[model samples]
Target: MDHILVTGGAGFIGSNFVHFLVEHTDAKVTVVDKLTYAASRESIADLPADRVSLVVGDIADQPLMERLVAEHDAVVHYAAESHNDNSLADPSPFVHTNLIGTFSLLEAVRKAGTRLHHISTDEVYGDLELDDPERFTESTPYNPSSPYSSTKAGSDLLVRAWVRSFGVQATISNCSNNYGPWQHIEKFIPRQITNVIDGGRPKLYGAGQNVRDWIHADDHSSAVWTILTTGRIGETYLIGADGERNNLDVVRQILAHFGRPEDDFDHVTDRAGHDLRYAIDSTKLRTELGWSPRFGDFEKGLADTIEWYQAHEAWWRPHKDAVEASYAAKGQ
Candidate 1:
């Protein structure tokens, strides 16, 4: 049986990937997570205990990583400080986790001669001009603007280094924004859905003109799995559903789903250095791995996502207090 190791397996995308792996493949999966505030084990509450092994730990710990890499057939790295606003507030953690942590994992995999699949973000391409018709292809130049994306871009280079210098069989995937079930409430889709459901004002950053290509988390996970299993070594694949929408349009869609008006949002100042637009060209992954996103429709996907959050208050409500406290601590 193939034993696969997943870092940050308790996180939103990581947790979803874990479930997808266990259900779809016979691989003996080991999950190593630091279980930070954003990571809730409850996300995997339904996973069978026997098929999965959860290791509570950090990926930057070289010793633990070396051992895990030696034992597993492949490593799927998903751990990182992902919040852009939080990264702007403090960049050290992003550097530590996204850059240093990725370096540590690459070193471990190199020593053990193991295969690795690194998950990356399209934010590495920075912002696109409104009139720029080009999407972020695999060959796009790295022009990351935010501290968070800069660190991720740094990590992507390291993955390439491992493949070039050390001959580590590695594949990288850069994906667009993800939205679906089990997402943290702090994220836009869930936050807006929950707020609209409870008769609260949705917070908007600036004029909410920022555009993003959103993909369902399930589609993203499937793309990751496909790339890991079939992509060429030392290559990069862009994973996107090609569903682009401006921030305000997404917010309006969520509000409409809840039978609320579009003007229910409280517009606020834009975030510092916020990227105006991000879109990905996933044609490479689709053509090479025969992977196509099944949930590319924003309207239907947003509706399904909103409905999931509405019906799962037991899963989301407990985190409300903690989420509020985090914002309060951040003084947002």
Candidate 2:
């Protein structure tokens, strides 16, 4: 697509995707973001005006969505209320932003006939048994555990229905946990990194045995682009890098990075209904689309991420205090 509308483009993964577009493709992007506490204009402000334009707005606004969708060749939707803790505290925003917002975008695409690609998460497939040896594939059945994941599951279903019932040109992808530069300190990896940066200890939940499949955000961006152009309409792809690590292991690595005792972290109350493990088999994306992660080793990827937070203190410093305070309230 030559001109595209990206919802939530100022947020972490979306901003990373926008940067990836600027570097890898010729498409011009118009970003629609609510600019919530999770979003930062500075994340996208440095992009060339000719290539990227920011529009402060909500994704659920039908008139606005229609206008932007009509003006662009496609919509790469990344907007959602994504935090699990916030969703638990109040599911209202998650319902509005993730469910209703997706419905609005689907309607716009249905009317405008714009090519659409929806971003979703692997959490929709719920957690797997630690010893299951199975991984989530495109055909995995939905079993969302939290309000945030449930809303995302709902949005993915909406996209599928729009494509089948209305013939809207659309595709969907469910990606693994993403970590890299530009990530908000509220997120797991960045939270731990910034905690140590500020002379605080990293915190773990329960026994810290929950496992997550991790993929660098940049790799997630490239995989999305591959699916957007070459993927078939009405199909779904699972994106991952096969980087799986349990919570305790990841925390220990973070501590080692800071030259602190690996056992320095505190155990916080575990999340309500925490998923046990998540693994994604991305064979389809790799074998069909020839996609592979650039950051092959998880430790290497994570070390680079730690270095990023070190070098870009100005970018993350402003949000550090407030994010930690929020976590502190939750005893995380």
Candidate 3:
């Protein structure tokens, strides 16, 4: 069986991708994660223990990366400091993990001469104007605004450099905001769902008008799998479901699903340097690779996501205290 190394496979998106790989392919999967406050091994509890190996470690550790890369057929890197709000509070970790950590992974992959697939966020394209009909494409120039996106942009450039200078077989996928089952409660969708279910109001930033193209994590995971198996080296693909919804609209939808009134949620001060909008065009991925999202409707997807969190409170409750503490410490 082909063996694949998945970095940050214990976190939200990373963990989902691991489950996808295990179920869809015959590949033996090894997951490397730092298991930070956000990551949980329970996310992957359904996988066969024997086939899935979980290594609790940092990605920047060169020796460990070299060993993992040397043995795996391919590497899917999903580990990074991903919260925009957290990045605004402190940028050092973003630089350390997103930029320097990615550099370390690149070096290891180069040394091993292994194929690498890197996960990136659409925030690297910076903000889209509210009236701008154009969607972000793969060829869109990088105009990262926040520290988090800027660091991610730096990492993307480094990956491109490695592919060009070192000729390392690598590809990158820039995807939009993802929401689905097992998402950490800190994100917008899950946080709202959990809070609403527990007789609390969902917090909205500013006037709640920031628009994001949200895709299901399962669809995003499947796209990652497609890129790993068949994508051309050095190519960057954009994966999105074209499901655009503003913060207020999203929360209201969740409220409606729960048979609660929209007025129940509270509006809070907007985040620092919040992107006004982000939308991605996945035409390249759709036309060239025949990859399109199976979950295309935000309403249905949102309802499904809410139901998942409702049914699995045990899985999410443990993280509630930490989530509150984090926000309280940030004074958000």
lDDT rank, highest first?
2, 3, 1
Q: State in Å the error of residue 210, model 2.
A: 0.3
Q: Candidate 1 — worst ten consecutive residues by lDDT sum?
A: 323-332
- State the C-alpha lDDT per candidate: 0.89, 0.94, 0.90
State the weakest 10-residue window (summed lDDT) of model 3. Answer: 323-332
Best candidate according to lDDT: 2
For model 3, state the Cα shift of residue 65 in Å.
Answer: 0.4
Q: Total backbone clashes of model 1?
A: 0
Tens-place lDDT digits, model 2, residues 109-199: 9999999999999999999999998999988999999999999999999999888899999999999999998888888999999889889
Report RMSD (Å) for each prediction in the order shown: 1.5, 0.9, 1.3
Better of 2 and 3 by TM-score: 2
lDDT computed for candidate 1: 0.89
Q: How would you encode candidate 3's per-residue C-alpha lDDT over 1-332 as one tens digit per residue?
A: 38999999999999989898888888889999999978998888789987799999999888988998899989999999998888887899999999989999999999989999999999999999899989999889999998999999999999999999999999999999999987889998898888887888888887899999999999999999888888999999999999998998998998898889877887776788889999999999989899988898888888888888989999999888788677657544
Task: Give stretches of model 3 more than 4 Å off.
Answer: 325-332
TM-score rank, highest first? 2, 3, 1
TM-score, one value per model: 0.96, 0.98, 0.97
Among all windows of 10 consecutive residues in model 2, the one with the lowest summed lDDT is 319-328
Q: How many residue pairs clash in each candidate?
A: 0, 0, 0
